[model samples]
Target: MVFQPASGYFCRALGAVLVIAATGAIAFAQLTIDADSQYRYAQSRFDSGAFDEAIVEFNRFIHFFSTDPRVPRARFQTGMAHFNTGQFQAAAAIFNQQTVNYQGLPLDNEAFFMLSRSHARKGMFEQAMLDLHNLMAIASAADTIDQARYELGWLHVDQGRWNEADQAFGQITPENQDRFQVLNLQQALALSDAIPTKNPTTAGWLSIVPGAGQLYGQRYQDALTAFLINSGLIWAAWESFDNDQYALGSVISFVGFGFYAGNIFSAVASAHKYNRDRVAEYRDLLNQRRQMPLSLVPSPGGAALCLTIDF
Candidate 1:
């Protein structure tokens, strides 16, 4: 049988099309299989606490399935993997991106919470506070709000902003006070009434009346410190005087005099600070009373103190 060139050419073209289609379908199947395998591997790694490995696999899954509906979940898992591994900054970045990319998504609250924690860990206190506020604003469940409020209080405490911390802690409802929330609230209340030790000049306050400034500053131990320091200097001056060392005595006297002067100044300053703090506290109480209807009348068994520390 003689082969017609035209029929042979048509056959060749048809075969080429079939080969191309088969090759494309196989590539697509292989791609799907690889994606499924990567996703499973990522999940397994996460389950085993191999966060770094999980992150790599999750990233691969995300890269392969960028347009897939499961992409958000994959990204979220990747961020969580980073968070579990203590790579908070990287986790935060991922979470932030997730929120931006998937706003109004179901995972918004989780992403916001993670971002807030990351900011807190990184010492970006103001940003953390804002994120916490965002979480509270968007939280649908009471428990979630309570948790966010508790974390917010700790963030304030970490920054030494005790008044704000107290306010945050006070938001927790009594019935929902978990051990963590209750303990943190108690700590916040204690810290609220106490002055922070950020100022080293507090030491100078003790120099004035031996322990007067420290006592005013609500640092009883610091008062003893001031007294001991002054006593030691005074004793040194007395010994110099008794030994008939006029020059040495004069030098010690001068040093003592400066310390004494500093102590007096510190005492005055500390007293001023103490009074100012007390006034502020009273003002805050008044403001609270004004804002809440419950504060209109005193309770029959005395006012319900939110949280009070004995010492």
Candidate 2:
């Protein structure tokens, strides 16, 4: 028996089915390719220092595949992108979300650590301490704990809070402390000892004794110079008046008065500046112990980020 020709309607139905199957397969392939392609593009942007653009691409990949295993990594990098681009608040938010939303994930510790940094960058020092505490609370993450404590100590030191710095740095083992040159804690404590502080008001009052004001400000050379110049001018002015050179005496007295007045102001200024410089010296020492430096730059249409991680 011979088979009859297929119907036109039947042929058309089979063609439709084939078209649907082919279209579905292509879509699946495209999705897979897109996830990888977008991830690579995002990474390239980061590597090329195009942090703002990288954030956009990274978020695009994450938005498309929220359930993909790579999503956590994308989330972390997204925070980094914001950090590199100087959107510190945005970075802190992203990192905070990762810690709260991605519990049990490996990125939780990292997220907390980065969150602390973002908060610190925003000058939310108290909030930064909270994040640092959260990072140290991860019992299973010893590495994160060490780093968090270290950064915490430096934060305290930066503010010249020696007691707090000592407390934070004390948590580490002796070996780790030595290895990290944790001597900043020791130095800070040492600096807390009462040292002499010159009072600006007293310095100004002492100016009535000529060089006495500069002497109180611990400017011995300046005191000597001021005394010598004032005395010389006064003597010259007196001699001019004694000789009846009234014009010369007037000029000398006028110039001598300015120097005398300036000396008093200079002494007061020097004392206050000395105190300010003392605080700044401690801060500079703390800066040397910072984990790393971070930078943000404006891009063509946006901002980008760079960070030097030492811890």
Top model number, lDDT: 2
Question: Clashes in model 1: which pairs?
Answer: 207-263, 208-263, 208-264
Best by TM-score: 2
Which lDDT tens digits does candidate 1 get at residues 174-248?
Answer: 766763446545553664455433233654544456877767677577667767777888999999999998899
lDDT of 1 at 162: 66
TM-score of each: 0.53, 0.64
Off by over 4 Å in 1: 1-33, 132-206, 211-229, 238-244, 254-311
Worst 10 residues of 1 by lDDT: 290-299
- Name the regions of candidate 2 deviating beyond 4 angstroms: 1-33, 102-106, 138-140, 183-197, 207-269, 289-311
Cα displacement (Å) at residue 306, model 1: 31
